[model samples]
Target: MTALGPAASLRDAYGAALVELGERDPGLVVLDADLSGSTRTQLFGQRFPDRFFNVGVMEPTMMSIAAGLSLGGRTVFASTFAVFAAGQAYNFVRQSVCYNRANVKIVATHGGLLVGGDGGTHQMVEDIGLMRGLPGMTVVVPSDAATTRAATFALAERNGPAYVRLTRESLPTVTDGSFRIGRAAELRSGNDLTVVAVGALVARGLELADDLARLGISVRVLDAASVKPFDEAAILKAARETGAILVLEEHSVLTGVGALVAAVTAEGHPVPVRRIGVPDLFGESGDPWALLDRFGMSMQRIRDEAWDLLRLRGRVE
Candidate 1:
């Protein structure tokens, strides 16, 4: 069986795709807010110097500039850290991108507290919640590098404002390139319980799938990457098939992806769903893996939760 975590990280794939996309579309322009190197847009900027713009430390202005470029018939991808992309540029995105419904894409890096040593200040746990709340905005969190690359290309074809979040560290790519936005991708099939996750947590679900499969417990895993315009059909179907659901995420449980998934599931399926994510509190300075383990966001925790949920449903040993 193939193991998780040995694959290339999504950050590298995202960076390489930024360059490839720039080469493919002459109208493809990249804007970085003084974080070209850290956000990894520098790789693209180096190749397409004329097409890439460094707008200094101003993230809000960067968003506006991107919107303006889009209005002028250019496809603009504004890159920045998640905190500034969502927090600092919130108004620019809401007014210029969403209000105008511009076809600009905002690519956020270092999303979630997994940003590690950089600590709480740089981490953006609320980015998904922030973008998901915007009107005319499509929020996506790719499970890995391969999927993130596909998402970047897919954004060129999508209309309206799009927000795609990426991580700073490398994550295993569990999805094998057949990702459709707003449609949940099932990695495992089970009749006992369903584990719905997005972004980095998808790896956790995959790991849990291996464990549960070994114990003769049927476990289903779904990668619900698109947050806004979510796949309600896939979610409800999973609930009906498994009889219960578990939402796993790297963001806060309050106002995070898990909450939105629960709300939608409750409305459509009304099935019992447990949420696994960061608690309603700020993160501390620590190793990313250690912090996730403590907050019940690790693969081990996901596996444990799946087992517990199946037992609660009386479907496991």
Candidate 2:
């Protein structure tokens, strides 16, 4: 694989990618709930002012408008903060988007405690958990800028309700290759343990795998970018082959990707699984990296958790 440097932030990548979508499809319209610049939809607004609609700060109303547009043969991409997407538009998305099965893509930025310094009010650590519970909704958290670009284009092409969770800070670009939705990408091949990671934590998981390999612990890391309609067959195969699995994420541990993986593995392969993510608590105002370390989202934490799970699984198997 080619070496990757620092990737573009989700905001930047989303803006550019959405603009490209607009260039390709005339029906592609963007709706922002008074966060055009903050969510980086301002780029689209600049390019196609008529196509971009800013419906004040009212999230629910914006969702309804987007759904109506979709029904009228328009592909709507609603941009907002994760809090507003999963909070204010909760009922609207459930009814207008998911229930009606509209082709609306909800692009939410500043997800997780990575939205640091904004405190608990802005950090959307539970957004994925909320969105994942909705019926007919495809939840995706692209690991980096490249993946986010691919996901943005993919969501635009697909017709249905899809929720995209993006981060506030820039992250390492681990994958420069294109990714297919609902397919897990194998970062490393190892039979000792499988580390299944999603979103921002994927880079850390891959680093942990490399570090563990130096310690004679072969680690398999899979990037589960597409959360909903999760690649259960791939996950089960990893568990049955490796006998242990560790799911990592930047969101809360409960009802998030970790819980979903645990549920899937328990029902199928019945292997020992460990979940590393934010505990059931709000994050305080702090630097993003420090907060990630505090909440066990660091590469070191992943390495330790994988080792611990490997030992436990070894004893069981």
Candidate 3:
């Protein structure tokens, strides 16, 4: 197996993407709500101070300003923590951005249960679902740093409200970063079963594919970075060809990509789908990766679950 390269943070890539976009589009503007340093938007703020707006701690005000700027034909990117971006600024996003279909990119960092010791309030487990629920909202959650940059450009190239969920810490570079909105990246090819995942879980899926292959169990791993406007065709094809699938993510199991995949499969092709994610509970304060391991998202548990699913199909003894 080829080893993944050095670890990198998504927020840094996101900030860089904004700077790149600003260079090309002179009208590209960015806004931060007192968390520029945490979200890494400070990089863009430093580069384009005239176009960057620092709106103190008011996430709602930042969002409103973003929408208003977009109305004037400016490409706007609003930065903040996931909790404040999707939770505290919900009304502003829903009314100003999504309702009007403004050209705004809500690129938020510190998403999922990966904000380390910031506790449940900062670890946003429900942000994806909240963003996905909005009308005309394009939600993209890249798996790694490179893909985060790709997602940033994709959202910027388009016109409308969108949300890009990013984690606090760094992730190993696993993918080639071939990302596009409304499409999924097929990382590994297999015929027996499929694993649809996003964020760090996508790396886990790739690892599981290799381990399962040694046991004669071919596992197809898909990086489902695009949560909204999902690739239903891909999920349906996996369901028909593989016969079973496992949906894993760092978001809530209730209304996340798991629910999206299950709904699509049920509608197109009936298949057994197992979803693994944060349960109907809140996140707590701990090391990001340690919290995930303690919550049973380890490689062993993932392998056991895959084997169990294969066993149900009489493929594993």
lDDT of 3 by residue, 189-270 (tens): 8889999999978888888998888888899888999988788888988999998999889988998888888889988998
Runs of candidate 2 with Cα error greater than 4 angstroms are 1-4, 315-317
Tens digit of per-residue lDDT, candidate 1, span 102-161: 889998988887888888888788888889999889998998887888888888778778
Cα RMSDs, all models: 1.4, 1.8, 1.0
Local distance difference test, each candidate? 0.84, 0.87, 0.88
Q: Which stretches of model 1 miss by more than 4 angstroms?
A: none
lDDT of 1 at 233: 89
lDDT of 2: 0.87
lDDT for model 3 comes to 0.88
Ranking by lDDT: 3, 2, 1
Q: Give the TM-score of candidate 1.
A: 0.96
Candidate with the greatest lDDT versus the true structure: 3
Clashes of each: 1, 0, 0
lDDT of 2 at 55: 91
